[model samples]
Target: MQDQTFPWLTTLIVVPLVGAAVLWALPSALRRFARPVAVAFSLVVLALAAVATSTFDVSTAGTHQLREQTEWIPAIGASYALGVDGVGLALVLLSVVLVPLVLLAAWREHPDAPATGRAAVLGGDRIRHYMALVLVLEACMVAIFAARDVFLFYVVFEAMLIPVYFMVGAFGGLRRRYAAVKFLLFSLAGGLVMLAGVIALYLNGPGGPQGFLVENLIGTQMSTTTERLIFLAFFLAFAIKAPMWPVHTWLPDTAEQAPAGTSVLLVGVLDKVGTFGMLTLCLPLFPEASRWAAPVIIVLALISIIYGALLAIGQTDLMRLIAYTSVSHFGFIVLGIFAFTSVSIQGASFYMVNHGLSTGALFLLAGFLVARRGSQRIADFGGLQKVVPVLAGTFLVAGLSALSLPGLSTFVSEFLVLVGTFGANRPAAVVAALGVVLAALYVLLTYQRVFTGPVRDGLATTPDLSLREKVVVAPLLGLMLALGFYPAPALDLLREPAEQAMELVGVQDVEPAYTSTSTIDDGSDQ
Candidate 1:
């Protein structure tokens, strides 16, 4: 670990937290300025994140950098510890970049007028509360990614649920409460199982003032059964958060019912926590169990690939379709992680960031369309290309990126994953590759239904993307194009961490079966 005297990580977490509190405590007279105030705070946080990223040393991407630690719970051996490697830094950057955009996209999301009926019964300024919850969520996202202590990570992990719960339940659509409850139930169940694993693993470690630090626990001696059991406990929690096929039911409901900006963060940044944990903590903490469980996990991932894509093809609700697509994308991430090849893990890490940009744009664009027509159903839209060309065009680019078009960012990551996985497990790679075809079906078919053909009766007069909306989307699309063309910079950051993961798992890249050589003969010799 490379420790920094300045508390960069803590400041990143605290700024948004203090912003949230300030938003909540604003005077009634100044309540009208809530959205601007919130946006300003988010922008400041983004600038700070940029500075932090600039300070990160890409040369030492394998080990944690800018680490900060202090003793917290001496009896239980927990400490306030934080740091970021290439992977963590990538995610932290993703979270900060998206927050200001999400805030801008949702600027007019909540009305300033007093609430009515149920909302009135729970009186307060809706915009203020919603923006504040988003900030709080931002703080938690940063903390979770940077946390280096097991206890600190787990605490922030569970604490994330509170803000998301209110964001959905209070600020979402008609079925908000039901969706929020379901999300909470699934997450809590996973967290509880993880808590058990955390306790068991700690008890097995060298108990001391800082026993729960990840570095200290990495190579602890344990029996085979105990380690495998603990690994399962942690894996199960991640899978649910990863929201793999069987346990993935909650995501579509939540995505469909929650506000679009909320959905962006929920699916975009928060879900990455699961796959991130598997890569950073699981493999290092329990290497044997990871190898033992690889085959089963790979099978589940393949299932998610096919199952999610197929369901996405059959979806009517636009939000649900996008949600299912994420399920498929996440399957690829999980597969790359378990493939245990340097290239595949690098792809998985890159996939996390790319997925955020592409899918976040999709969700936000879909939200904009839904807001215009007052519907999320594909059947409710048509001929929108003529009516709203800019919106339709942007949506097409984002959708194409989702399908992993050759010139887009997702293609690079998905390609690396398949190539790497093929070397380790040919059949799994073959099965997962079918998802690409299925992806085209879902993306193009949905585009045709929603943005092509004759203008639907009510949508002919639909407006195009507003200036603010364009501002929200332009950077996301720009980044995708930039990364797609030149991925070397991002790949450089990802390579060492991927290699470290492979090292921990005691695996190496698969070597070629044969080498070919050719010699040129000169005409004079002939």
Candidate 2:
């Protein structure tokens, strides 16, 4: 047997830490340099990920790649072991992709904040601090995806709270402090609960060569009670992050309160932490309990779909409306995962990346509109297409993508999810598809209200997107088009790792029938 020792996983963690340290150490006079430095660091990591991914031998995906294992604490049976399969690698790439784009979304723009009682989309006065926080937040998000150790995962998980908290509290909209507090309380409480679960997993694992590594957590013998408790503890934490129904009150407020750049990352990548945890930790660690809890979770997912849609329809603020739609989208992602069909799981994974890109773009475009028009009320943005044709067109593409228009990336992944879910659970899939219909309504409704009608008075005839904003959105739009047109390459990269994840979770040999992804080439290029 060949023993290949790669420090790639550690680099993923270390690169971000290096970026954060530089951002902190550099004086405010050099703050202008942070965005590019952060982007450069992120791109380097993405490149490293690509190399790791390129050399991956898919036929043997059941094995870990670029692994780095070392003992951290002798007493707790824990070690600093890290590695990636398909899921972690894909999310890590997605996180890297979004971080630079988010900084670009705010480039050349200041955070001129709105007052306490107003309805503003993206507003704040502290541009430097907001940008710095965003970079730091990206580092934390990347850590979450790259972390393979259970303890490291928990630390990074809670560490994410601080940057986003400041982003919301200091530079957000009218109720920034309130939203920040709400976000912190909900997150802190959940993290504490999950910490207990992580400790329990460490304590309960079978002694052997395999310990504290997610890949080694299979076939453990735990009582039904312990499994249930562990599952619930972790579930609650992820749920808040997932912002799933009932526990999701914090999301809309945070989205509404945070600046646009912050909201983009919040919805785009941070919220994914919850679903990722569900897929990575909850299902694999407590397989039987996940099965036990599936029915209950599915029910919550269904409710979130309906509730998110209804709330989105009722929202007047543009950013808040976008936030609510995320709730609905998250329900679909959750539903697919718990459904446990092979195709559904693949679709779930694909959905995470696709939704992140499409939704992140929409939030960015919406921010541009909000800043120019000085209001997020749908009534405030009429005939925008007349003054800013380019901006209107950009928003339209993102909006269409959000509604899963055929040939767009979202359509491909969401179709797979609905079909796969239908195969696994027909009734749930039926109702979930309704969420798709509501998606169209919400997306188009927002578009019509914001872009059609006569140009309202008092609105600035803002120019089209600046070079920086275009530089950011252009890649996103191109990416959406490219993926919508052809997804085989990405899917091929993902296949082996996802397959391996299934095996470790004891669901080996469960490949989704729809997993072939022939539809990516079926023709639809608008």
Candidate 3:
């Protein structure tokens, strides 16, 4: 339990939301200050998140901490409840860490720069609106991560699509509208399906305040048919959000068209809700159904790994290529979760953070390239390292992390995932391992094509990373290194949730077999 003296979790959600409102309501005369104000608010939330993390009792991390609740509507068995286990805290931290950076990176997303050839100028209110939406999106992200009530989670889950939809549609590139509509349609379809499951869970549950609380729903009684039906409802939604293979079409489009900051939040943090849902809701809520669905899910996960990697390798559009890489990375996350081992689950959880940083940097750096070159096509520029060694170097490091380079943040999580998968399903693990090769091929190939050849006809004047841009990307790159060399802090935070999740699914690691072979000389036993 958290100290009653302060509602830290609620504050984390409210601060950004309040800032959004203030920014939105500011008079036009004073509106020029909106961006800085929004950034300041995000920094405050980051500070609060840091404080909350520092005070967390890792010894009790397996269970929810910093719990805060208030009755929203007792009649429907819904309440405004929030809490964080190690997994949720880790994700919340990811959100906070990324939001301020995103704001800084996107400081000019609204007003199109001449070189980028992005959307035309907007009214004076555009920056205000954009910054407000970003803050709102951040608030929803925090709420979803912390919500302990299934009903509340669903509300925030569906609500999240709103700000992102606008961000894509209003502030993106040429095809922003199409991409935004596609993203919204897919997400809404999934949300509606998941809502059905939430309703069913409520109807079949023990009536009263405890009904929607996750703590009360686990191990609850339901007919096998009911359980499976509800599981499918939830799984379909999460799978779509996870944007697992078949349902992943919306992502590349959105990534290509949306502003880079929007893409960062969408792929880096928002998409994580899908895998997070599966871990926090699906398995625990329907243990039997999860195990029953494991084989099929694992197969799909494998397909996502291979299929996404292949597509990424083939892509000409840089943003779309990065999008496909996330599809592949997400496959690993889902594979780790459904593998039902402590190591795998923890790896998946840790991967969420690592993926956000690694992939986020990739997108940001790629966006920088696009902004400078005014083209996303791979063939448009070459020999970039000679002109912008710092930017190219940062991109290379980020790319290596994506490929799970040793001593990088992603390597720790990826290794754990593969090892855990091997323990559970050798064949699946083997197939998924192929993704590493594909990852290397795509990343290296992209690097070679874009940075190795002769400089394009007129790109010599392209500048290296500016002070602000470097500042924006430095922490993300630095953390990847910091975490890579020393993941003990993160692993310690993740262990408890992994154990708890394993307990829910009744899974334990399979011990390795050691055969004792004795050489019997003349039938003598030694």
Candidate 4:
């Protein structure tokens, strides 16, 4: 809060936009400049976020940092407010870190993307434009995570669709147009529904003295029916974005359709929107409704967990399988949220960050394999372990992390979730625990089938991961290990925020086996 502490939010929000603009202005003739420019821009943002993180007082992370609140539409009582609490700050850092990695993920020379059919559609500065779109999307994500005002959050939330719409439509695979259209239509309809909730929150809010800032909206009274409806409106929007289950039909399509980089961001960062909205808005704004809807949400989350994994088990397309796996992982996150306990909430938060790191790594590594093998089909791969030891090893590490192997980041967080959920809802927790087992099955099975089999004669020439690919994957694996060993610092960061969240939800005084981690559910579905 000190004046000299740094304008952290501004730096995070602006650097990407500025970098993106410059990259866009660069001559298309200088095609080689695009990726580097994009990476450099992201690194600067990452550096700034790192400085903010390091200098940040971890103990006080529950409090918003370096907030900037200014009147936007005074008549409407909405303001342009920027702030980062423990959870938001953590996700912001994750989002920032992934940008450069995403750029680097697909740094390899890919095929010219079959210009034969869509020559007219794919014309001009395509690569640079893609890079620019990535930057733009990153900016929007940071803004969404940092925005303290619900209305501002909605703006950034909806705006993120643009870049992704193009990413899928532009750089995707076969059926890319279909996937893009589906993604766009689903996301837009959800945003519109959420917009109605935003308007209702603004217009019907406690208007005696101030406006509809999130800080003020909490604990405001609403009839249970109204709260439930508004909560449904909000939850529907986020769920579609989370792409949970039946609605999640788009994820595999989108993932299979998008380029590797786009999939990483889409699944890794963008999908977090759904879980994040629940934690940030839905539960707090409608606690009674959240409680009322808890059973249905938990059931749906369990289904997503089971169904996505089941779908993944049957997948032949590696990318589509990964996509389905995300839907399942999202199920865990949602369960943690609606569980309504501190440990579950914290676990959900940690899971989001971990999912970003691990899944992001998987998508990137998958992209690498696809690039070298020339196909994403499981049948296209036979024995890869013998040919690409490093690639196989990295894939194994990413796979283990995805499966929440003990001592990995996800293991600690997910364990806390199961433990915490057990404290609140034993049945749901038990059902969810089966998800962990299923996760292991899917990830390990996928790895075994794709990487451990005998080398198909055709891919006998598949080279090991190059130095650049190794460099890109190493940090993700390392972070997984580091966080697994020492999650205390992160736990401390979430403590106060989780406490405050619990207080609002009327959950209190629950003793747990683990003294450190707090976990709970945010009401999303139903």
Q: What is the C-alpha lDDT of each candidate?
A: 0.91, 0.78, 0.90, 0.83
lDDT of 1 by residue, 1-526 (tens): 5578788889989999999999999999998888888899999999998888888989998889989999999999999999999999999999999999998898755343232111211124787888899999999999999999999999999999999999889877677898999999999999999999999999999989999999999998999999999999999999999879899999999998888889999999999999999999899999999999999999999999999999999999999999999999999999999998888899999999999999999999998887777777789899999999999999999999999999899999999999889878889999999999999999999999998899999888888999999999999999999999999989999999999999888777775313223445767776
Which candidate gets the maximum TM-score versus the true structure? Answer: 3
lDDT winner between candidates 2 and 4: 4
What is the per-residue lDDT of model 2 for residues 282-320, given as tens digits with 9 covering 90 to 100? Answer: 887898899899999999999998889889988998988
Report the backbone clash tally of model 1: 0
Q: What lDDT would candidate 4 get against the real structure?
A: 0.83
Estimate, for each residue in 457-478, the C-alpha lDDT of model 3 and write its tens digit: 8789889999989999999999
Which of the two candidates, 3 or 4, achieves a greater TM-score against the reference?
A: 3
TM-scores of the models, in the order given: 0.95, 0.90, 0.96, 0.93
Best of the candidates, lDDT = 1
True-vs-predicted CA distance for residue 304, candidate 4, Å? 1.2
Span of 10 residues, lowest total lDDT, candidate 1: 114-123
Task: By TM-score, rank the candidates, best first.
Answer: 3, 1, 4, 2
Better of 1 and 3 by TM-score: 3
- Compose the digit string of candidate 4's lDDT tens values, residues 245-317: 7789888888987888889999999999899998888878888888888899999999999899888889999
